[model samples]
Target chain A: MLTYIVEDDPVAAYLAELMIRKEQFCSEVQSYVNGQRAFDSLKEANETGGALPDVILLDLNMPLMDGWDFLDAFDSLAIAKDVCVFVVTSSIRPDDIEKTTHYKHVRGFFSKPIDEKALKRMQHLLEVPNN
Target chain B: MRTPDYLQAELLDLAVADATLFNFLHGTVLDGLWYWDLQAPENGWVNSKLWLTLGHDAQHLPPEPNAWQAALLPADFATMQQVVAAKAADAACHTFSQVLRFHRLDGSEVWMDCRALLLRNEAGTATRLVGALLNITREVEKEAYAVEIANHYSTILSNQSVYIIKTDAAGNYTYVNDLFYERFGYDAQIIGTSSLNSIIEEDRPKCLDVVAQCFVEPEVPHQVILRKPYNNGPVKSNHWEFKGLVDEQGQVTEILCVGYDVTLLTENLQKSQHLLEVTKQQNLRLQNFAYIISHNIRSHSANLTSLAKLLDGNGNADQKAIFLQMLNTSTAKLAETIANLNDIVTINTQGAIAKEPRLLKEEIIKTLDALNVQIRQHQIRVEVDVPADLLVPVVPAYLDSILLNLLSNAVKYRATERPAFIRLYTYQEPGFIVLAVQDNGLGIDLNRNRNKVFGMYKTFHNNDDARGMGLFISKNQVEAMQGRIEIESQTDVGSTFKVFFSTNVDVDLYS
Candidate 1:
């Protein structure tokens, strides 16, 4: 299965890609620098019948087209693929978490450092027990 | 047959009918009557009560219409003659009435209501005249007394040095005098319109409350200061005293309001109140400020500490190098945040920031020189059109920082496909000198982010190099110098930033 990590911070995205590869969580991993690039790639992939990612790791604060706006644009697309979205925001603002995070395709909300809630959900989605 | 007893009795009753008829007219209305021989023209019989009513002795007066006509004013006598001649000329005119005033014996005047009937012969020529004179002096005095009282009250209300208005229970203007019309400069057409509409919107509820209170407790007067909009003038604050006038049933019928302009008196007080309110808002903002600072700085500091622990673990040279780099970035970001916070605190605490006069064009030149390297490297064009002699009083440091922030933003957000240009110009408005910075760059989508454009750390673009502190700080600095910042932006076109310097305020402060 292909996995995509859409984040703005280069270091964070690189770190997440390395960990996903080391863990052998999926066959392929793609990294996107921002939500707009991720959204555009998704739209092009859908139009061209390219491979769709099974899971998307989304970040909230990016320069252009933040995670919330991306979800809105994607939701309007009404893509038939049931790709799961997991929000990974650095800030723990409850008010921010309360909005746009309840999309039917959004599987879970998580803070930075890959917290237990995210890991548990990922394990469940991949059918792997945490070691 | 001609001498029956019943016939003799009927003839006697018929002979006394005129005397009884005259007696009934005199008894019921309690006035007197006169009989006149119009054919003879001098045989006029005057009743004793008519003379007695005027405090005159009937024995001394002659029985002629001219005798009573002599007591009437000349105009009234002429009116009497006209009425008499009209009936004599047209026999179809059977009756006439006139109100006549006569001189009493004691030199006081008495008013009389005189009514007359004319009798005619077969030839339709008037022969005899009969009339009644009623005493109506008391009624005329009562009517005149009422008018005098009304006139005195109206004079008092009109001349008062305050505005006087009367409204019905529903607060609609029933009466607005000349003074009220002139002071507010409203035409007479305002009568019957609502008084509440003239009051400013902000104080409508308060005005309604006071007016309602007066009506609820009619005996007690309510006083309040309300803002009323005047024609072609600044909204005036007026101190009004309202009193509810009640009908006999103790229910309020109307309200009377007296007020005077209190705008000058309350202006300074309202200013201080507004300052206090602003201070309270800033205090609340401090809480949000503290929250943001903790979130940003604490995350950076925590990341550095965690990286150092990881670097100490048995990692390879490559891993260690990455850890060191991450640690460096974390530490620098933390320091930058702290410096930004310091600048914010400085601006937030300014009471009256000291300002010095600087040439507008010269300052723009200095700022453009500082951004020359960026302008050259990006192939961005710069244009400055400020007046050479125009000088503005501002804090030099803030002006430099604001200019640098705006210029850097223009360069940082330039659309790659377009030839980027930044234009700086200045112009003088009525009470301000406005410095506008125009740029053809990646403009903000103001439709979605207008409210948050000046918000702290609100960045709308994909440039991660943006810490989102520049514009917020620029806004703070402009405000600290007793000026304001404004922006007009569109999504794909460009943005214009304007800073308004109040000429009136700055001159008043330093002069």
Candidate 2:
């Protein structure tokens, strides 16, 4: 399994990457500082016929294209395989939670600092087909 | 065959009997009768009816010209003489007539119409003047009452403050009272001209339709505003009401327009509407601010809780060290976010602050000096074109924060391909003094982020230090000093931020 973490804070991104690696939830793990970088990488992969990540953890607040903008841009792309997008944001705001329903690819909404219990749940979601 | 003495005696008797019959005829029907012999020394012979008309006994009245003149009012005596002179000058002028007032013994006056005819002798020379006098008191009284009513209405129309105008069936002004002319700055020359032409071009069609309706229904009134042409002066808005004036046959023959100036009232209403709009905008911003605050605080608390959960679980030394570092960083970020929120809350709750007149140039220079290191790092070319004494009302600390944030933003967001350039200037606009900060930098995409540009933690750029709190804090500070900030930007071109300070701010003594 391949996973992508899109977050602004380097510390948060590093922690999430370390947790994903420690749990061995995915065969490959990549981290980006903002939504724009992740979005560009995804677009480049699509153009080059490279393998796309199975799971993408998106953060709401970031410099240069935010998570919402990324979702808007990503929704327009034509891809054969479905990629599960989990909204991993520090915001517990009902509005942010409600916004996730707008994207069909978004699978779950999780709060910050992905603990052991959250990782287990995410791992379970990754194993489940079409979840 | 009779003797001369006997015939003379018979002639005297016949003359006395004729005189008795003539006096009786004159006394019965006529109020008075006068016979003036031009050749005689005495003025004339007047009957007892003359004394009766004067409200006096016949015994008391001396049948002399001087006595009759005393009974006539002094002003009428001269007019009576003129009548007699004119008649005497022209023999062909057979009749004389005049209406004169005569004073009575009871201290009251009676109006009389005297008519006289010139009686000529056989040689065609006038010898005696015979006239009849009739009392016309009741007729004169009725005529005087009619004049009083006419004068009363004329005074009311002329003195009334409201504009009053009358137009003919063709919509031409037939009459405009003094108040109408004075209010609209029109003159008598406007009469016989189309009154509808005075209405503004935009309102002309509607006014004409109303006038047409008035002609159809004479009982109903039509209303409209007529713009008064101002010669390089403030506009005067007036509200006018027009009604049809119908004749006895119920045909609309005229239009009466009455109106008053409503300029002040209209201005006040517009001012109130503007205030209402401003209040609504402020309320919406406050609601958005509350949401942002709760979202940010909750995000921070969630981060802390997750970090604590991770620490509680077992981990390797290397992993634990990394987690500790991340936890410290998260805590610091949370503190910084709280501090920014506190600052906004303080500004919002404090309301308007004390302001003083400070030179805009001085404030801009101070801001530039503080950001000198950043300016040098970016090699920005700064240009300031501001008047030396152009003062703006602001709180000193708020002015510094606003200028510093704007100047730093220009440098921070500058494009790397070209040398950054910043321009600061000050100018006066109606009701405000504006300080504009312009920059050639990485401009914002206003179409996508117009609503979120000044929102807390809303960053559009990829810069490492783009915390997105600068503009939010700056806006709050500006508002505290009774000022506002506006932005115009185009992607990759440039951005201009204009800060407006109210010109009517109350100055602080201790600047």
Going through the candidates in order, their DockQ values are: 0.16, 0.31
Q: How large is the interface RMSD of each prediction?
A: 2.9, 2.5
Pull out the clashing pairs in model 1. Answer: A63-B461, A63-B462, A64-B461, A64-B462
Give interface RMSD (Å), model 1. Answer: 2.9
lDDT of 2 by residue, B1-511 (tens): 7669987887678768787656666787788887777676247776779888888876677645667667779898677667777777786878879887888788988998888888888776778878788888889999999999999988888876677888998999998988877766778999999986676677678778878888987867788766665432566777878899899998999988887888888889888887787678778768767777876777667666756767888988886777787789889988998998898988877765678888889878888998899899879999999998888777888888888889889988886788889998888889888889999899999987787788777787766667888999998887667668999999898899999887877632112
- What is the lDDT of every predicted structure here? 0.79, 0.81
Least accurate 10 contiguous residues by lDDT in model 1 chain B: B502-511
Compose the digit string of candidate 1's lDDT tens values, residues A12-79: 67556655665676789899987889999999999999999988999876656778788888898868
Model 1: per-residue Cα lDDT over B1-511, one tens digit each = 5669887888678658667745565745645566778777555776667678778775775555577656667788677667787878996888887788888888998888888888989999988878788889999999999999999988987875688899998888998877778777898788889999888888999989998898779967799998877765888888999999999999998999988888888987877887787778777768767766765675565466557666777878998898789878878777988998888987877666668888888888888888789899999988888889999888889888988898888888876788888998998888779999999888999866676677666788866567778899898888777678999998768999999876643523223
DockQ of 2: 0.31
Off by over 4 Å in 1: A15-28, A101-104, A116-118, A121-131, B1-243, B247-269, B280-288, B305-321, B371-382, B408-421, B429-431, B441-469, B489-493, B504-511
What class would a CAPRI assessor give candidate 1's docking? incorrect
TM-score of chain A of 2: 0.94
| Residue B182 alpha-carbon offset, candidate 1, angstroms | 16
TM-score of chain B of each: 0.51, 0.65
Best by lDDT: 2
Candidate 2 docking class: acceptable
